[model samples]
Each structure stands twice: as structure tokens, then as C-alpha cells.
Target: MTAIQLESASAQSKHEATLPELGLVCITVSQEVRFRTITRTRYLQFDQKERKKALKSIYEDNLQRLNSALTFCEKHSIKLYRMTSNLFPLCDIEDRIGENLLESMSADLAKIGERAAKLGIRMVLHPDQFVVLSSEKPQVVENSINILQTHARIMDMLGLPRSSWALMNIHGGKSGRGKELIEVISQLPENIKSRLTLENDENAYSTSELLEVCQNAGIPLVFDAHHHICHEKLDSYDDESVTEMFYAARETWDNPDYQLVHISNGKDAFKDRKHSDLITDMPSCYREAPWIEVEAKTKEEAIAHLRDWWEGET
Candidate 1:
């Protein structure tokens, strides 16, 4: 087997001396999976046999990609390995775990959690975009809460601690604003709260605004570099103002237990979310953060960039 080599991002700064774990967005792999799915569509597309075959192939291919990347990291002596929901969901292993559709994902996750423990890999699941906590027509927010609570139940069923291998990445909903955001989180059981993390988003609130809400509610805050920039500038704030907003949130939310964060290249023009190549230009402030996940347009490129950035080679 070829050893996957990873580039180190440590030379750039002392804070990065202990390189934060790195991961690809995996959503980029969507094209590969979708392409194969389309090809398999013509043959037994929805039939149980066909669905099983296609899903199996997708899982194998994705694991191949991850294993290859992990091999690369091993060869280079890199320490971080981050996998987001973007890649895992493509496997559609939801049916393997839990009870109904709501509980379906837990079994798959329990197996994944065990694997992560054995492999020393960190597994983080991004909240599905559709999951939300709002009193709107669709009631996505309530449904999302139910989904998470069920996930909590599933974890318990598997004998996993709430803080075990998996982590839930989430964003506050804009439907009900601040008060509603508090209500959504407050309703969750304490066990669920420990597993749930709130990330900063561009449209909903600035890091400062989110910190204010989470601080009072006792929910941990996640800072997305790009989302902070988009939010500040969307309302006409300049680059300097955006920078100020990001650091401000960092200062307010920084704590020992809630230390993990998301970092990605985002554009000022938010007409469509186009992952920016300027990730190399990440503000100097984030170099010291203990955990940062790199989300890019594609996994291959993200893997390469993170390696380069990690070693200060970029």
C-alpha cells in the first residue's frame, strides 16, 4: 500500500507547533459519488439489491479515498485527521443504526465511533442543512431538535458517552432570531447539550451576537471564519470591521472544553457560496487555535492545501 504523505502546517507559526487536526469538506466527493450514482441509476436504481450495491460501492470508494489520505498523513507524520458529515452521509449507513428514520443513523454512528477510537481519528458530524429549530410552517427547528435528541438516545443505546467519538456541528436558526435560538437549545436534555455545538454563520448573526446568545444560554459557540466575514460585510461592514468581529467572537467564546472550530475560505460576494482559494490568507489570529477543520470545494485539494499550510510550505 502506498503511504499517504501529509504536509505540515507548523512552520508558519509557533501556535501551530502542535498542528491542529485537518480534514476535507467531503462534500467535494459528492461529484464522484453522484456520478457513480447516476451511472448506477440505470441499473436497479431503487431496487433493494441495486441500492445496496450502489451504497456499498460509494462507501468503499469513500473509504478508499480517506484511507489513501490517511496513509498520506501517516507517511508525512501529520497528527490531525478530521472527517465531517459531508463525506460520511454519502455512505447512507443511517439505516444500519437506531430505530425509525429519526433513530436510523445511530447504529452506523456507533460503529463509526468505535472505529475512530481504534484509529485515533476525530469524527465530527455537521448538522444537516435542513435541520433547524423554528416555529415556522415546516417546523424544521423542532424536527431538527427531535433528530438530535434521537441521536442522543442512539448514542446512549450504543453505550457511548455524550462526549465520546462523535460531535455535532450546528448553526443557529434565523427563523425566530435570538430568543428562539435560546428556546431551541434550552429544550434539549443536558446530555444532548453536551454533544451539540453552535457555529457562527453569515446570515444569522455576527460572532459577537452569537457569543452573547450562547453565553447566556450556556451553549458552546463555533466560529466559522468565512461565515463571520460574510455576515459583517453583508451589511456593509468593511474588511477591517469583519476582522474585528471575528476576533471579538474568538475572545468571547474561547474556552477549554469548547475549543474546536471551523475554518474555510469564503467570498465577500455571497451570491453563491464559492470556496475561495485564499484560505492560505487565513488571518494570523487563528494559527494558535487547538482545532480547526478545513472545508473546501474538494477533498483532494483541501488535503493538499492543509498539508502545505500546516507545514508553512504554502
Candidate 2:
């Protein structure tokens, strides 16, 4: 090859080797809500045969898309990702597919996990807002447990060791009953609890409140910067608080060396809870955030914009 070609290849290798793993910007399965809803509405279909067929078809498609998403993350050097909540819509739909669902999805899931492992791509799973483990109602907690179990199953299928990288974040749940919240999380099966993390919710719980809950529950805290800003539960927070909390979260994990944080911007004129297309400004002392999950509307586009902004500021 020419001298120019050799130099270009060397430079590319050097860049990849030194790329700072500040935080892995992630993208969900699909940015478009309606488009990502690959699963068809099965309740309306009365025939069991048709419903089973639909279920299998949707799951197969979701898994294929999921594999593709993982590939995308690897290509972009995004070391962290949030799996589509509905990747496997029904917890037990695998029953219809004959042999155990985990067994069926094992090969595909393992393949994705292997790819992620090679690239050090951490997968984060967030159940829908409906998961309320600390709710006063027993049914809510029970159902939430079922969801948690499904997440745990996914972790097992991935064969990734029980670590923060395979985090399944849940809010502190109901507003009050702090003790119950701790107790509820404590009661979860060890497998489910192992990869579990408590994220600060905007309306439901404050960062400090959930931090305490996570401490009491013996789990790490996944601080949500946007939620913390919008949270009225606390009077105020400052730069020091951010650093303290960042470390506080770090201490809760076995691998404190790498902490995962969550971030998002408002969709409108100001910083509201709604996720915007991109974050114009970084959160206070964003450097403290070891690993961040950008929950912005535009997903990867938002990350790309933030990277450009971050580079300019630095």
C-alpha cells in the first residue's frame, strides 16, 4: 500500500485504542414509538392458533431487530444500551413455541451477548412505568415481580455475569412506604435482585430519597440527571451534591470503577421531564458521570450532538 494509506490505517487504529469510554450513549430498538411496536395486538384475535402465530412472529422479528441494534451500538462505539422493553412482549409466550422460551431464544440471545461481550457493550433494561414494586397494592408489587423475573431471565440468557453492566433499573415505586419499598426489593429472588438498580423518578421519587432506598435495599443507584432536575421532592441540589451522589452510586456497586448514570433533556423551551431530541447543554459537572444513558428522543442523534457540544466545551 502507499505511504498515505499505511498512515491512515495507523491513525485509525490509534484513535480506536485511545477512545475515551466516558459513557456509552445508547439507542433503543427503534426511535419511532409506533414503528418499534412490532408486536400485533393479540387480545383482539380470538383464535388461539392465530394469537400464537402472531406471538411467535413478533418475537422472532424483535429478536432480529435486537441483534441489529447491538450491531449498531458496536459500530458506533456505544458501550451501553437499553433493550426494547417489549422485545419479548408476553413473559410466557414462549410456552406456545414448544420447548422452554429461554431455550429457544438462547442461541440468539447468546449470540447478541457474545457480540456485546466482545465490544464491552453493557445492556440496560428498564421496565415500563407501570412497574410499581412499592405500591400499596399487593397485586402491583406481584406483577412487578413477574416483570423483574423476566428481566432476570434475559440476563441469564445473555450469560453475562451478575454485574452492574446488565442493569435492570426500576423506580422507587410509590411515593411513600420507604420501608416497604426496601422490604419489597429485599424479598425479590436473589437472581432478580442481583442485576437490579433503583433509578430516581421525576414525579414519584427524588434522587436523595431513592439513594437512601437503594442503600437500604442494598442495591446501587442509577442517578437520572433530568429527573433530579425536575424533582421537587428535594429543595435543591448543587455541584457538590452531584459529585457526592456520583460517588455514592459508585460505592454501591461491586465494580465501583465504572458507574452508570442516566440523562435526558426536556422536549420544549425549558428543561421539563419530557425527553427532547437532543441535549444542548451538559448537566452540571457531567464529567462526574462515568457512564451515561442518554434517554433523549432522537437517541443516537442526540448522543452525536452532545459529543460535538462536549468536544467544543472541552
Candidate 3:
């Protein structure tokens, strides 16, 4: 299987020499070559009798691809990875086939987790945008719970710790519904709640608002510097203000060493929500973060650029 290739020779050499001491930089989903994910539309194409069979086949392929991804990360000395939420497609539907994925694929999941642990890699998941637990509608909230439960089950099968270090990150939905979100979170099982993390978004919750909710819910907050700058309430991107927000978010985590921050440059301007192909300027505040997930369009290539830039400065 094809894997991410570091484009910069200097960056490659630098990582080989000094990556162990530096905090990890993560790449989302796939790099260079995208991993395969099946949509509900494609699943509907299969006949009723064949649907279960098709789902099993797709799931197995996804697990195999995940193993390949872990191998790629180990080879490149990339220690953090955000897994695709579509690893087990259609499993969230009430009447969906292959609902017993944990039982059927237990061995595969265990092996993947073992490989990651042995290689000293950290894995995380970010459920898609539709998981809105704070929605006022009961059905929407119920669906969101179902989706989150599915993610928690997968993490359990992988034998990951029940903590934010292997987080299932999501945005604060429906902006002023912190009370509703906290209530729903209280109802969830410990397995799901322990691994949950709230993040600030460009259009919705600002750093201050999310910090309050995270504090109430007893879960860690993921500080996104780009999102903080985009939100009108906290428009300044100065080092002092950003660093203060970073510290506030850091305090929410159980361990400061497990604190995860997101870094990205806008496609056009500083306030733009669209991520650029490479991160040109990272905040000085983020140097204190333990794990930084690069949100650039170029995926692992962007990480290579950041590594080169970081090495140049230090």
C-alpha cells in the first residue's frame, strides 16, 4: 500500500535526528494518497442479502488500511494520528447492518491497538460534523448519542485508555446550549464521556464560551488558534491573548502533557476558515503545547513543512 512520503530532504534528516525530544505533530485521515471510505449511498447499492456481506468486506478493508497507516506513521517517526470516523460506515443507523462490528472484528481491532502501542503512537478520532449533541430536537440529540457511542465502542475494542489522550474531539454545537450539552453528557456512559473533548469553532463557540462548557462538563478543551482568531468575540491573534487562552484550555486537561492544540493557516487571510496548503506561521504560544494536529490541506506534506520551519527557528 502507498504511504505518505516526506517531500523535504532536510526535514526528513532533522526528524531522524531530533524528533524524540520534540512533541508530536499529527496528520489527519490519510496523507498523499487518501484512504478508502464508503458512503451510505454506496451501501444502498448492494442488495438486501448482500448488504451485510458488503459491509463486512468494507470494514475489513478499512481495518487493513488503518494498519497500513500505523505502519506509515511508525516508518516516518510520525507519532500522532487522527483516524477517519468512517472506519465502520453505516453502523450508526438504527437498522444498519454490521452493528456487531466490535464482536466480529475484535481480533483485528486488538491487533491494530497493539501495533500502535508497541510503536509508541497515539491515535484519536474526530466524528463528522453531523454529531450535534446540543441540538434542541430530541431525535437529533438521540442520533448524536448513537454516533458517539459507536466511536466509544471502537476505542474500547482498540484497548485505548479511557481518557482525552485518545480523544474523540467535536465542536460545541448550537452555540448557546451549554446546559443542554452538559445534561446530555451526564447521561452518557463513562466510556463515552471520558474520551470526549470540546473544541472552539470559527462560526460558533469562542474560546471563553467553550472553556466554560468544558469546565462544567469535566472534559478537556481543544484550543484551535485559527478558530479563536476567526471568531469575532475574540478577534485578536496576539501572542499574549492566544497564550492566555492556551493556558486556560491547558488547565482543563487531566495531564498537561496530553494537551492537544490545533494549528492551521488560513487559505487567504488570517480570519479565513479555509485551511492553507501549508502552515506558514504558527503562534509562538503553541510552542508549549504537547501535541499539535496540523490542519493544512496538504496533509503530511504540510507537517514536513512545519518540521522544517520549526527546526530553522530553534
Inter-residue clash pairs, candidate 3: none
Name the 10 consecutive residues with the lowest summed lDDT in model 2.
2-11
Tens digits of lDDT, candidate 2, 1-314: 32223324433443444222333333442552221343335433436666556656666777777777777776777766777666676644434441244467688877777666666666778878888888999998888888778778877787665655577887887897789999988888887888889888778787788888888888889877667767743333354565567667777776553467777767874446677887675556556555677777777777777777768866
The lDDT, on a scale of 0 to 1, for candidate 1 is 0.54
Q: How accurate is candidate 3 locally (lDDT)?
A: 0.77
Comparing 1 and 3 on TM-score, the stronger one: 3
Superposition error at 72 for model 2 (Å): 1.0
Q: Rank the candidates by TM-score, best first.
A: 3, 2, 1
Top candidate (lDDT): 3
Q: Count the backbone clashes (under 3 Å) in each candidate.
A: 14, 0, 0
Model 2 spans > 4 angstroms off:
1-41, 44-46, 93-102, 233-240
Report the lDDT tens digits of candidate 3 across residue range 1-314: 00111112222443455332122233343553245657778877878777777777778888887887887787767877888888887876555567775478898898898777777677888898999989989999888888898889888888877888679999989988988888888888898898999999887688889899899999999998988888854445565768889999999998776788898888988778888988887677777667788888877777777888888978
| TM-scores for candidates 1 onward, in order | 0.66, 0.83, 0.88
RMSD of 1: 7.0
Give the residue spans of candidate 1 off by over 4 A.
1-17, 27-111, 153-160, 234-258, 267-272
